[model samples]
Target: MDGRVPAALVEETGRWTFGVEPLPEAADTAARLRRVAGLVLALERPDPALDELLGALDRAERALSRRVPADPAPRVGPAADGDGRAYVDHSRHIGAFNACFPEYTIDVDGSRATGTVNFPVVYEGPPGLVHGGFLALFFDAAIQHHNCEVGEAGKTAGLELRYRRPTPLLTDLSFELTRTVEGTRIHSAGRLLSGDVVLCDARVDAARGQRSRLPAVSPRRVP
Candidate 1:
């Protein structure tokens, strides 16, 4: 079983202990779907046939629902929680509803990890800038990716961010994450940049063996 979560390798530097792990692949379907979502977000003048297109999509959704009835949520035991195979690649799994993930590819090495993303219109909040929330999300994901590879799977306990400059939309931004471990916690620092210009910087604290909060409720079934 592919580790449901990511795993990291510890490196002995003769000075400090650190970790590095391979980056996850960007799934083809997830990438394409994100592009589709971007186009939808950028749409301006409505197409004359949009109504018909919506109707056809609705019919297709209903047909699919009939063929594949909803299944109960799978039960997870405590032992199963720590199994790497139980984790899913955050950047690749389309199941997470994160359409912006396909915008980046992460690189990892013995001491550090870096990611490059091209922000599209779908992530815009200000006139020409990427959304602040998305900036936080990117930093969180980057920090978690680093920890998941080197430490036990964990969740963010705290994040502190500073937006130095506006992160422009439809432009490439670079991010770097460096980590330090103290007992059961992982501390990471990163910067989001556009070439030499610093767009944002973040510090994150992650606690090992943590799980995210449960979903508030099941999503409304389609059709």
Candidate 2:
């Protein structure tokens, strides 16, 4: 069989991220893959090993992500309350981002803080069960905050999610993020617990960055 299938995919699309899914430009995956292959074949080189080809692509993708780790949008919440928790953003669409859903709070007091969100009946997805996606959100925030606890804030580079058991909507779920420093990469393990039962767990790779540094600002001012 010819390797043209994969080659054609790479040639048509210059890069996977440039022409692929979920981009602001357009959410096209199949078309992008085809384009990528076409670009690869147009090259002057002859047949290269499939493994070698994949390796080159992987390197290029990682380089792209390293340049922009996290969304630069400002998501600052309301003024901090005396207890160190405040209801700043009330999101109705994504249950995870909204503090109104489970009404959870994070205490940024240097070390790790426990985030507990009580899933109500209204948040149910399955038959009297909380949606699995919300759990991922819980872990995401928890692990992210874990890095912030120890004076090291980082963007999520990689995340591995696992669902152990069905989470009951009526119950209250508590999540905690434990941090481990492995080189410059900050590793974290997040757990979703309802009383004694384990609901879900996740392994997150958060990239360390300096909090004091600011992004390059444009010369234009916001007058």
Candidate 3:
């Protein structure tokens, strides 16, 4: 069983502290994930992606460390118990979200907003298609904007999606959110557009729930 381990680790690192040994005799899917993890751990030479991953992790650590943990609410905002809506600036939030989905952008229309996301091979899953899980995330984010018209201070209660076609890798896909209602329950619809073709449609149901009892931030007025 030790021989099943890769030479890169056994020869260089000598012993790996994987915490748990692989039980390949288990289900094939889990078995395969473990095998990949072993190979990944055993690599000695730094792959191009390794640097990107390390950089991302480092940035994430710094961001989390910088987050204010002492406050029950935002650092420079209204009290959480207030009726203020909880929201980040569309541009600021979109820029941050771009860290993961590089090709995403915010489309502002007055107070309403929509976002467009384009995925490439770096996030590819199927042979020539984007992963369903990833597609769900895009839909969730796009539809969440529909809540902008809602009381502007609630969390999502449910999300529904219907994928119409294989979201092709490297395609210029756009997720357009159409706001429906914006009150006690925020309702919005989302469509995945590959040019003019519709690939998926989604809906979000957001309610006046609280991640905290604290009031959410409202956008600052331009000086």
lDDT of each: 0.61, 0.53, 0.52
Between candidates 1 and 3, name the one with more favorable TM-score. 1
Error of 2 at 46 (Å): 67
Q: In model 3, what lDDT does residue 93 have? A: 30
Candidate 2 segments whose C-alpha is farther than 4 A from its true place: 1-102, 106-112, 216-223
Ten contiguous residues with the weakest lDDT in model 3: 2-11
Ranking by TM-score: 1, 3, 2
Q: Write the per-residue lDDT of candidate 3 for residues 1-223, one digit (tens) a residue.
A: 3112121121142221111122233235333433444455558887987677678779977996665243334322334333332233331233232334333666745335666776655456778778877777776655544443232424568878888988887666776776654557667677888888989887777675432343233332222
Each candidate: RMSD:
8.0, 20.0, 18.9
Q: What is the lDDT of residue 79 in candidate 2?
A: 15
lDDT of 1 by residue, 11-67 (tens): 352211112111243255455566766776677877755667678779978996766
Candidate 3, residue 39: CA error in Å? 18
Top of the candidates by TM-score: 1
Clashing pairs in 3: 80-214, 80-215, 86-216
Best-to-worst ranking by lDDT: 1, 2, 3
